[model samples]
Target: MARDYASRCSLSPVRKTWLAAAAAILLAFQGIGAQKVRVEEELEAYPTESVDLRCQFIDGLGKTKLTQVSWIWEPIDGQRDNIAVYHPIYGQSFPNLSFRDRVVFLQNSLENPSIRISKLRMADAGRYTCEYATYPSGNEQGTTTLTMLAKPKNSAKVVTVQAGSKSVVVAQCEAADGKPAATIKWLGSVGGNHSTTTANGPDGTVTVRSEYRLVPTPADNGRDVVCMVEQRTQEQPWVNTVKLSVEYPPSVVIEGYDNNWYVGRSDAALLCLASANPEPTTVTWTAASGSLPDTVMVDGNKLTVRKVDDAVNTTFICEAKNKHGASKHQITTIVIEALEDPSSAGVVAGAIIGSLLALLLVVALIAVLLTRCRRQQRRGYPSSGDSIATGSGGSNGGDYGNKARLLFSGTSNNGSKNGTGANNNGPIYTYREGCDATGTLTEKANDFHHHHLHHASVGNPPSAHDILLSGDIDEPERRKFDLDDSMEEEEERYDRFGGIPGGGNMLPPAYHVRRGHGGDEEVDVYLDDDMESQRDGSVISRTAIYV
Candidate 1:
């Protein structure tokens, strides 16, 4: 009862008044109130799917005498038709029309009358009114609006066209034959304009088509364009992408010419490059003035100059041909006078580097020699109160030969000196005097002992002949002889008191002295006959020496 009252409240005043009168008459005859009737207020379904238009009557007042129930269709265009009906005695009836076999009552009785429609079409979308009539009460009806949905077939494609100034169709998108039209939109990274047109089908379906227009160019080739479609049947918008193909004639470019070609230059070449959708078929090289010179050699797109000369100083032309069209490029050649050889720079650089390295080597050698000389000078001479022994020996024999030795006594006392500036405090130096003497260390020591003892016998100091040559040899005389290179290479032997033992001597500074048998003074003398002076003012003998 409450459901029937609510449905009546939603209707117009005329409908409410008619329902109130029917309820009053039913109450007056049977002493029972009106019963609730229900029908789906709204219904939705897709194409070819079954849908149920529900209509039920509740006899809360105990069978208010239901006579007949019928299903009616009321389209939005005001066209009406009776599609289904149910009666107690006449049995189920589906009208003999478009919905004859496709629609029927779910139950063959009037208690809960509902209809099911099969093989539904887009035109089946309309208002369905389920009407009921009885002997006591009048008609009671409920209306439901049925909505149909469809998913459109979406597609997009790009059209190939030659490059032109005027605008033309470059891409297209379509959403075909969808219930309740689908919307289409164009999008891309490129710039263009699009137009949309819609058409309605006889079966109540709509088709939408969109075209994109743009000025075509070669640069637009392979660019992407997007098509987006929206419809009621899809949860999200459908999208498709297409690449544009724009064709054009061949474009040519020339490369590899520096314009510094000289008369004697070689290995000069130029290349011709062409860009097009279809690759170039033929490449030709020529001279702008006339035929190509004999100095030039052409290989496909490349032109090489064997030897740059006056003949190769003409403008060069390169032509490329393809199916679309032909294109050409040219470059002028300027030949200058032959300049200095390029390799000369490397030769001069190498020479300068070599000279600097040679100078550096010489300077390093001079530095090493000077350092050695200073160290030798400092070590060769001993100071006062110091003793030193220097000698040179060879492997020629066990006998000593032409030995030059220096011996220092640690005596600081001043003593009488000969013209050779001999002093008791000065070290004794042995001078070579060309004398050839050969003996072993012991024999030489014994002989020096005998000679020094003979000098000590007369109480006479060592004479100048013992330590100096006959006359002072000048610098020129010192360098006049060939000095022995192995003077310092020989072995030198020392005595028990190898150095001075803090003792004073009556003789002048001695040369190459050693301890004799019986603790006597001994000296290893150098003979002047076998001696030669070096450029450094030092004397060396070619003969081997001992001790």
Candidate 2:
């Protein structure tokens, strides 16, 4: 009902359910009209595990009346056969012989008009239709469908028996079903030893059984004989396990691993040397060569190994008997060998490689950081002009010459000096008169007096380039002082006739150039010591104020 309410279904069951619903619903729905005959059917008094065929109809007034109900059966050949399975109105009720003792109509004739049938058979699995007609009016009637399902069977039981018993013993296998056909079997413990055990009767229904007959004996106990039962050809079969106990002392003894084994193994076998009511017994090893492992272990009913050594060449044997008889089997040996560890090497190698890769990555990162630090340090500016001042003596000259030379010789930078008194990395020059800076000095300056005393009285220094006697040439002097390449600004702007913007830009302390006319007092040139910027331009123009 829950499955149907979900409005979903499977192939076989759902088809049958809906078809039954259609038949029953049709009978019920048609009774709504006037003067109609309604049918209600049911079964009574049948054995357990049988089908109860049923149908019911209720009109507007809800009354009950006996009527001639029509019943039909459609064989697989598709022929519709009318069967008087039951008809209360005509003072007659006939059922199919196929039903025989298999069904009983429990419907009461005197007081009730309903037809009830009981006692089910698997053959009753089919569709049955009932049609009820009214008095003096066969035309008006209602019909319902009936379905009978065979009852299921009880579980199967298994039994076991042993070899060589003196007396015959009967093994009985039983299972219950409701008119359900059953098959029985007598099975042997070993493979391919099965017999189609015959049941008591032809139909094989009601009570079905199989038996194993053995004469009275002490050796018949603790042997397996199983019974299996399956209902329909398609149902999954079920089985049982039973051990038959024989009354005699044990014989034909054998012992080994409960499971199977492969080739080349060390095994201990407890063999059966004798068989009888009172079996004979003793233990020992047997083979072409009586070779056995130096190490052998034994317990009450078991043999084991603390270690399985391949050097032992695996062989063991045991002999068994009661007071009756004895037998022997080849020694069973179990083989085993050492297995090397496979994953450890690969795991270790991977770890080593990964560690190396990670360490290399860290080292590379550290190198990059150090290079950046050096670059920053190289760009660091000195706080004052004297930060790198170096002292020097005059270049073999006098007072005015001495002081100037002393000031300008050697270096003002931390590195070595060039001939021009500038830092090491540059082109140097000595003053020459009207000679292009391209010219070389006739001789290096041994005396500074030549340079400072250009307009002085008395003789000029000997290495005299006419530059010493030249006119008041401040132009060349200043031009010679080109801005350092490291300066923040280029030197080109200084050549614009010295009208360069002289002070702070954009913010306060702004330079007002006074817009000096061409006629103004001779320009007072001021060279900024803060920067040697003009590689020939203005003083350095620091792009943005640092502080």
Candidate 3:
């Protein structure tokens, strides 16, 4: 459980859910009272829609007598006294010849007569005064002026873009046959540098565009943008305006030179890029448990660590901040060992080694005791079983030698070789020099016994015993023999010694005996060479290899 806890220590689900919901609510509230309208803050940018203007209060009984209301205009240059007149009372429209068919108003409802002046010319682009005479309680007159200035047919276009990338921005202001083509204005949140111009066409047509771009950030995500279309003859700053909404999302990234490589002292860098539509205000770095270096430096999209040292092993943190909120990154660890000190670990290492050595000694002593006890159990009849114990007699035939004779079960108390042979009628002589080992070998013979003697042709065969590997079985270079091969080989090899046949099953690393194929003759001569000897002629055996 402790391991699992260390594996994950981060934000939980409930906190994350609450934070997200809160952020969404705050953004919605920011937009509630932000919608507004104006005439010409920036004329080059505007939304395309139907034109609607209602002058309802101009006549106090606004909707009544809607049919009686009409319009009139005077021609420019005094070419005629009255350019045109629409009189619902006369049920007639009389137009001066010079201004004939030049104007029409399609709307009624006691609103302002929204007139469309056709074949508009430079002289037509002037103050258009709407004169109203109302019969509401008293006679009253009022006027509102709309200066008809030549304006562009199309507003400057706006383009959407992603944050944290380089880009180019360009827009054109164009119109056909306006008195003087509109001027283009480019506006944004920050430094908006733009070039303006007019490309003249036949008959005073004009094309004007603004050219500019900037690398955007999250802070630039949704900024109110505007472009102005200024007409030369207009008294106001602009004849029309266009509003642009630039939308880009928050972008966070790691950028650097060889960021994943092991960074070095002076030639390395770490770049943390934090950008958002609403615009982040600040960026910072922190250490998990230590102070951040004083030499650290930051730029718009980059955070750099200078002259890193061994102390750089501390965890590093990145933070991005703005007025709305802030975000932090998970701690990332870096280890810096300036130079390895081989001798520094000697003291603690010595203590660990000493403890392990003491443990090994205790384990070895317990293992020895267990081994001796098990061996005694397996050899219940050892005193009568071990025989032909051939060795160079250090003190010939003494009490110890007599004990050896009794252990073989060969000689009787009267110093006669007891016979379990065909010549059991009398005492038997032991084999020439082998008698000292078994107190003597039996002279009672059979062809099978002669075959068994062939195995002992040399001096004395090695004692039937098992040997362990030089060290632990876990050593890679000293791979062990498979249990099955070791056991099978042990049984076959043990038959060469004097161990009797028909013992119960034995595990590997143990000595045992078995009868020959016929199962009638007991093969007492087993040939196990494995011993504690570890001698020059030790034979190696394993399943993974073949000889």
TM-score of each model, in listed order: 0.59, 0.25, 0.23
How high a TM-score does candidate 3 get?
0.23
Highest-TM-score candidate:
1
lDDT of 1 at 113: 90
Listing every candidate in turn, what is its Cα RMSD in Å to the true structure after a full C-alpha superposition? 14.2, 26.0, 29.5
Candidate 2 C-alpha lDDT tens digits along 1-547: 9979666655588789999999988877664556344443432222335544444443455454545555565433466665454444354545556644544455644223344445543334434555555444343434444433233354444333334524344356655543444666656652213333333332323555555565535544455667676554326665666555543434444555533332333453343333444434444444334654445455543445444455334445555555444544445454544343344779888999999999999999999999887654433332232221121211211111000111112222322121111121111223232323231222232233333433221111111123334433355553443324533232233233344278422211211122112223212111123222332222321121110
Report how far off residue 351 is in candidate 1 (Å): 10
Model 1, TM vs. native: 0.59
Positional deviation of 335 in candidate 2, in angstroms?
42
Q: How far is candidate 1 from the true structure (C-alpha RMSD, Å)?
A: 14.2
* Best candidate according to lDDT: 1
Candidate 1: lDDT over CA atoms? 0.68
Candidate 2 root-mean-square deviation in Å: 26.0
Error of 1 at 93 (Å): 3.0
Reference-based lDDT, each prediction: 0.68, 0.41, 0.42
> Per-residue lDDT for 51-110 in model 1, tens only?
988888767657478899999897666788988888899988877589998998888878
Candidate 3: segments with Cα more than 4 A from true spot? 1-82, 86-91, 94-99, 105-126, 130-140, 147-194, 198-207, 210-426, 429-547
